[model samples]
Target: MTGYGLHTPIEYLKGVGPQKADVLKKELHIFTFNDLVTHYPFRYIDRTRYYKINQLQADLPAVQVLGRLISLGQIGQKRSKRLVAQFVDDTGIMELVWFQGIRWMEKSLKVGSVYLIFGKPTLYNGQFSMTHPEMELYNPAKKNIGNLSLQPVYSSTEKLKQFFLDTKGIQRLQETLIPWIAKEIEETLPTYILKSQHLIPKGLAILHIHFPSNMAELQAAERRLKFEELFFIQLKLLKNKLLQTNKFKGHLFDQVGTTFNTFYTKHLPFPLTQAQKRVLKEIRQDTHTGAQMNRLLQGDVGSGKTVVALMTMLLAIDNGCQACMMAPTEILAQQHYHSLLHLIGDLPVSIKLLSGSTPKKERKELHEALMNGSLDILVGTHALIEDTVQFLNLGLVVIDEQHRFGVEQRAKLWRKNSIPPHMLVMTATPIPRTLAMTLYGDLDISVIDELPAGRKPIKTLHLFESSRLRMFGFMREEIAKGRQVYVVYPLIKESEKLDLMHLEAGIENLTREFPLPQYRISIVHGKMAAKDKEFEMQRFVKGETQIMVATTVIEVGVNVPNATVMIIENAERFGLSQLHQLRGRVGRGGEQSYCILMSSHKLSNDGKLRLQTMVKTNDGFEIAETDLQLRGPGDIAGTQQSGILDLKLADLSTDQLLLQEARNLVLGIFKDDSTLDQPKNELLRKHLSRQNTGISWDKIS
Candidate 1:
């Protein structure tokens, strides 16, 4: 009953009891004795030098020897069983094997005594084995008084190693619960953040992070537990973004009437890029700050994010408030309701389209013109979060590819109206700036990053497979200059573990290279039938298919401006932000488009750094920081079901300078205690009120 604030009952500690404390509360969620002393260990082995079977090799790293079973036996039988043994040490002999338990390791071998085994050693057949090593016995004055100098490991489960809880039985229950609570672990940071981040006190950083007596106190106990787990997850996402911008209260939109200057001066189909007038002047200064604009934007794939989400839905229809946009498919809400009815042509602004295939009398007259504010902008999919979709004064929503929708489907579009609207979101993938500083650190981001002035930079290249007949003669010279062609692939069949290019055998090898009444193709993928992938993506968006043959489900809903060559094939099975979104579906046409990539002359150094960063330079934040340093932030936190960087010792891709020094010491402790009601920050406010995670995986889902 000391400072781990003892909630005791881990079936009364000492090697656990009530059935290994119900298998340590069903496989390692370890209930109490403060979850078995904060079940830490995920690495640490040094066992202070031992290696000697002639210092084994095969890329030797994990070692420790002083061996000797020198006997045991029994091998290959039922399910090819094994046992082996041999061991030896003072400079030679090896073997050890097990193939699991081997009759409880032949009734716990003791033949010729001397032990301390540990692991890692391979070299098979020309001899030297090891298999599942870690043993014990040998003593040497209790291993020089620091018990085998550093050990820890813990992360177990094959049903808690069939209840012996392996990781050396959870390091023999943390070597009996760390000398009974490592002298009562207490300090939860704040002795001026332990002498201004020099750290190391919570009881010697939990007894040198479980048994460290050396390697510089295990790198100062892994920098004081990865700066107390990224300083309480950036002080719980900056105190739920400062208590949600001080409890809501937003809807401001000071009118920019005449439906946003009559569509930015006569239906603006081009010319907004000064990074779209600096992200429409940061969404018109966050809808003239009354707060609720949860921003984000990002931009990249044909950056003109649906023309800055239709000029911020014509600034919520010039303030009489009503706007929406949802996406995440209905063929990207009928490709954004036919690109905002072809960019507000004839704009007396009334906009519609809701989906799940509308029509029941056009979704009952588009839900009585979106609940009577006579609909000013709707565009849909996730069927506009139907609670029978009501919004009359929706006041700007826009989500589109917002990590393909989640946090309870964008909190049912923030429970529509009665305040809480102004959102924005958008994505076109390009996230990495340390995963938008730990998952869109409470929004407000904006990016656009320039692309519109006379658009041409595409030109990529990289071919191979002997440039398939010079990429079918540069796709029949860009389909005789009427320009189109996509080709894509990375399997849609023929996958005996990928040697890709399949989309039905690349459209039966491009219908024998430009066949069918002089080349016609189309295809599309995610296994069609969304009205047959919107009729083969509107016959390659009305250029009547010069060639589409897809899969990467036209990565981010097709928007074809008379296509203009993409190609891809196995291009080293993609990912550099999916070959920069399949090279932004071919520079959304203004001519000179090309992407190419082909592959198969065996690429792999991350497929030649994603075809030399797609022939060097299109940028999407430098290919999302080289796809977050080649495939990491767990594939961009796999659609961020926000586990706030489910970090174990911080690493939002190599700790951005310890995540900006744990977000600048939680912004200088909320700038000298903004409600952490100072008492020298009462143990950082009772360890953030006992690790309080009351929902806010950056606002839930």
Candidate 2:
């Protein structure tokens, strides 16, 4: 065997010099042979079929043609110069054009020589022509040109092309690199798994992934590789969970005291939904297990997650311990404080709001209460993690909209007590189960899928700019019925490039239409000061304002049960998740609520699909799944910085079944051998150790 292996630097490869390797490293992050081998093609082109010149159609994908170059010349001035060639097949003639490589094409072409041309055909005026067609001299002796195998198309950049490294160039490098390491590659999975899953060997899968001989072989290669990728990730997450349960000790809350029973029996405002009851039971089971609870609470906007959280905190207080809830924004913190306060209803549990806007004197008193175990529950923004805000026996932490905070910030909250507190992070934005399994795989998840009783799903409608007057009339009608309305614009201020309506112009238009004394409108946005924004939100909440004009700043944490109308201006600029969240702002009250999505006539296909999806269903999970398909997992709520999303092949959108299978297989393996110390599990143990270099955040939730 040769000395070089997968670890060899890419520059030492046969066809790659230092300069070309540097470009590859910067453009495609290919620093080693393994990096290049694993940089699989996004797609492949069929090269076995050759289209006749006359059979070519307009706007068709790239096609291959065999023809003879009969004439070639340059036209136009230097700036507009283009090399044009007339190539004739047995049936007809077509023009091959190139605008960039004029001199090179002029020097390379020979008249009356048969050549192969491949490119997309475009119709200009009345004639079909190909621009920058790939040209090669036809040779009947070699079978490589028209082989049955598919041609790989690797992703490339203009900078890489400057060094003669485009898609075709990268394919050539793979051809040389794959064979060199194929023999040296080692199997990562055990023999039993490979046999049970009907997977090919690792070496053979890598070979076929780069250059498959047939469609079936390519699919098999993809299946094997995707399973491997997802399997290792599941193993890591499951192992983290196992280690957390075994290594970390948590403060046990083994009793339900007067506070929890009092609120449930008398002060509870409404009956709890079955889904909420199930989630509370899950939390209750975790808190008393003597293991630190790292749980994710997911529910739709009006699903009463806050009530479940309040009850969980009461359990902590009943055990002679303190509980704290942290929100990403000050507005959300205050909302939680008021919600909990109203729910407590003289239950003798102390709850206070501490945020950046809190006065110094109030913070001092709140700190004292917390240190002396007097503050039963504290709700605040990131301020709760401050050094001075210490709890006497911090037992539980509830983070609302947890994705908005960074990892280190969440870690700070976990480090508040000598023993890590029970963590129950909540999100109103629904996450698909596949995504939840991958992103929060380490955390135990409990979803409150059902909305509260007596709540109606928001009636969603899509409207163009022409329907503005009618929408205004409808808004006035709702306001006349003693219901508040919300007009959410995508832009807070006028933008030069965007022609959408801004909040300032929208407020002006509303004032002109509704007039002064009859309609009281409040304006709020991210740019407004904390107190001012809170005052405007409070006005809308209290029915003092008939209409509230704002940006997406009100998308979360602003709960106005009386606001029955939500009109989102330029709704096409927002994504499906954002649109769903904005729609959730309404539908909190018993009366039938409406969410009107207003946009210009000009809309992309994606924009249309998003609006249509919102109008079709109120199921946030379905909407979230569609959103995951429309926009991949990266742009979702919390998966952006999740290093696990750097998946090379496994698509979280389409690979749901595969992900589940992998997860189940990992579970089976762990059930048999938790430590992976058995002889049959040594491969997995070695692979996991090799990948365990990053800092473990399992204990911090």
Candidate 3:
């Protein structure tokens, strides 16, 4: 216990002194004993299974074989040099090779000794080979429990290997430390929890997780550790939610006054879909709960989320409280401003716009109007968060494309009001339900699942770049019908590294194909000046341009009802979510919209999956789920920075059952004991207080 506990420095462990300790800290972040114990293997191997040389297959994951080394020699020149050896068993012979650590391995190889080797097998030139295999002397007396147990394989870097701290080296240190770690560690879960969940004790789980004697033991170890890790996360999120709901008093907008009802009855352009009405009902309920509301709204592109946000804002206005909607980009903010203005025609609501490009005098007038409580609804980007832009009675805040903003920026919005205005965060990028539950676990989620009634399902097609002329013909036909077209390139300039279509090349190609008098073209990109970009986007939106050549700048909010064709150049470079959002740019009008995904023939498997997903279905949730499985939660747009998805073991995409179980258990516990102050829940509080596995999402959300 003195040498090994949660806080024991990793440097004190055997075989880990100053040099190796520094590498461990820098490379793997193993600063303490708990860090080492919890550095669970991404995978493990069963050492007991041994195959003959003849049994080796190219597709084999990792196979173990016993043979006697017949020869050892070096091959190739300086940089390409490798240590090559051959081993022969009673059945056959196979080659073993090592490109790294060649000098050390060449000296260590014994010519005639029986050796046990394990590695992934590859077949080349009709011969079997194993590169960089783990080898050891095979002796019955020395190969006892260690040989029978599942061996851990840790991830290592070239730098770590240079310091003699590769997977095998780290495993040796673990072998030295595991005995004491098993004895000194204390259970993190309570006795009641362990009993109810049928979990093994903490110390034993740690031991078995690194070196399990059998498959059942390994499974049990994984189950216990995953439960503990996921449990703490769920508890932390629930606690944040509870604190927000309990500690902060909400601005009660109980009145369903004129602005809300009058607009719903008359000025509404179309009857609200059942999903929209349902979301509005939920938001309406949250505003009057006497507790600050933190809600997340998720819907596909053109799913009428903005309409719901507009109605909710009117609720705040009806109660004599002002509301503001913040977007990630100025272009998006302006789009919202125009959309809301059109929706609220003749309604007498004084809606104002603010962004980075706002005129000085106009900005001053907006500030005055907002301070005087005369602005009913304000729409803008981060410019709205300026300290000088004070709100008179900001009661509700609607943030569009919520993922584009960081957690701190959102928290800054929270600080804008004394009691923290009711928040409605929205994203058109559909997140999987399981992910939404974890990533936005603290916020109540309202999903508008169905699209509007008049809208038709978009027709999607995958095309090779060789078919560009055919696509051009289709675009010409669409333009002939007075419909605009969008030709989106994945890049703004011709990047030498990536041979994809850029905006400049695309504009030239389109001009040559469409000719001067036949089509007017507008180009926009991120590198363009804000004013110029906005001008080009507005020209395209107003149908002054027959074709718009742009980057993903149109991915967020550039609504053109007359645009009937969306041709994405190098579509394979775009992710599933981005492709879906870009496809959303079209299909806004009723004239049979089409989204043509144009990419080169050389698409990787992942790129093929993305393109196939776009062509297969328009279901955003389904596309989001496939994207999660393909790109993982870390690479997804929002979850990368949000530490909520920084899970070590439990995968939000696949481990839904475990997440649900943990969430349900926390719900039950909080129902009876909100603070976890009950006598039986003391262990939970202690565990949560010391939770430092990764970044804490409590303060972020």
Candidate 4:
């Protein structure tokens, strides 16, 4: 069908009136004929094979049988009422039962009718029976099952079933629509691509996806559709990348002058790792090219990302342009400000902190200094993105924990100057290759995949609740060694009231065990005021407290070198990526650090796998890959509502090869035709124009 025909209202389709259309709209979001056509089935059943009643087994999977409804009757009273039909084939007899829809089934079913029933078989009292089996009238003389090979099973909800829009009802709609759609639908991909990829026609793929002739056809249809979905995504990303590099002219920072060299040689605390050096070189090249620099820096926690960021900012300063770094939280912003302040000891550069908690008079002076070109580097939270917080010749922008900030928020920072700044978005979360390709394909990517020298991998240990005393003893031992500890909880309050151990109760328990004068503990969580959280964090940082009991609020920002033991309460409740981040809070210093995962005995399979992954390896990328597999991309990236991840058919976990191939294909196409204006690529251009408007944040990052 043409685009106009595909966009036709679902209410106008055959056998669908306004009420049924509204039900489909509300329940499944199927508004247009295209939506209905693209609602692919999750699985399929083989209708070519039928089992006789005598061959039925309770443990067998769903089976199909041809039989006659010899008798029908109602059994049991009121709520327990059920409609039962005695079905018999040439070999033997079996019972078909319906409980909840008894009245409807009783009114519709006819006795002595030949029916094709499909359902899972169960044995009750030595008799074979099927519950809520799918039934249809059989006519062998007319060859009713002539083309029935693989029967597609669609997903439907209870609400949809009430409106007669069950799986079978949807299948009937497809049966009525696919023949016309297959004949009228236009091809979306270019002829060259279709030929090179050996892909079936778009319309044929659509038909086969919903109603396939065989297993091979279904697989081919899936492959084609997956490729198309991933192809368009990569095309948009790479195109945006091309547009940014070609269109936005960024500030030129081609000098390695006083600030960067003086800090690198004079007051540098340690040598930069090769990975860090490599990333800086990449950024260095990007800034020198004069194209707007939008690079994503990925590294594990404690991998010297801040140092790289500072050096990049120094490069900007050396080029006579100001730089700024934005963090997601006040604690992180403060940490960066202090860490930078300490690192650039007696250096000539002027750095300041800006956040919501900054006093009015201080904010006024900071703003003045910022606009007068006196402030070389400004680190702050979301406060830096406000309209009043403008910068003088802002040339470089570094965002920490980039995913926590929305794209629009980052875009606001991008608009700080007339010409967009060199954007360096830093994330400690290691992204899987597939996810990074799909979610961040538009941005240039650089990964610092190694840790700095003298850093030892944190040893991970899993413990059950029964080992509480031993864990407490170990904590005391660590505390006695003059090394601090951290106890993290998933919840702050007792509101959960379930098996989870919240922070408040944990505090009471800790106080009882460690007793005041000898052991001081600080408590923090998301609900605390900014100042209060900062005070508690400082206590931990200054080693005034032996243990800090907090929630995941400390996951990203708090850095303490003296703290060596991290006890995560109810660690099973955390995702793998989160657990890794929490584990990263310790082990910052040279001494060997340990991460103890304390959980109840009721860990689920996923929870167990997460713990096992933590214990097995300290590689953030590996944990991220496992996290993607366990939680899927939306949960890991928290971009489900961004419209960037609104994929229908492609699975990021399993389709990595296809995604890479699609990206490579796009790169190849761009080499030949940067813009799809050539006559041979006309189909691709048209299809892209018809796609949903590109993501607004693509150009900025």
Give lDDT tens digits, candidate 4, residues 1-701. Answer: 34447778999888999999999999899998888999989888898899998898888999999989999999999888888999999999888999877878888889989899989999999999999998878866554322467988888999999887898899888887777777767888898999998999999999889878889999999999999999998888888888788888999998999889999999778999999999999999999999989999999999999999999999999999999999988888988999999999999999999988899999999999999999899999999999999888999999988888887898899989998899998999999999989888888899998888999999999999999999999999999999999999988878745768999899999999999799999999899888898889888898999999999999988889889999999999998988999999999999999999999999899999999999999999999999989888898765664567777889999999999989999999989998898998998888777774364574465
Model 1, backbone clash pairs (residues 3+ apart or across chains), number: 0
Q: Model 2: residues >4 Å from true position, as ranges?
A: 73-82, 100-113, 139-148, 693-695, 698-700
Rank by TM-score (best first) = 2, 4, 3, 1
Candidate 4 or 3, higher TM-score? 4
For TM-score, the strongest prediction is: 2
Per-residue lDDT over 1-701 for candidate 1, one digit per residue giving the tens place of the 0 to 100 score? 34334577888776678998998898777788767777888887777677778868899877888877879877888988898889887677988888877888789888899998878889987888888787888877674323748777878878888887878777777777767686776677778887888887877777677778788887888888887887777787777677666677778988788878988898898778788798889889888878777888888888788888888888877888888888887877888888889888888888888888787888888888888888888888888898988977888888877776667778878878889888888888878776776676667788888788777878888888877998999899889978888888887889786666788887887898888788898787786688888887887788877988888887877878778788888877878787788778787767778888888887768779868887998888877777777777766735336656767666666777877888888978888776698788877777667767354534521
Colliding residue pairs in candidate 3: none
Q: 407-459 in candidate 2: lDDT tens per residue?
A: 77888888899988999999988998888888888889999999889998889
Candidate 4, number of clashes: 2
| RMSD, candidate 2, Å | 1.9
Relative to the true structure, candidate 3 reaches a TM of 0.94
Ranking of predictions according to lDDT: 4, 2, 3, 1
**Where's the lowest-lDDT run of ten residues in candidate 4?**
139-148
Task: Estimate the TM-score for candidate 2.
Answer: 0.96
| Candidate 2 weakest ten by summed lDDT | 692-701
Q: Between the candidate structures 2 and 4, which one is better when assessed by TM-score?
A: 2
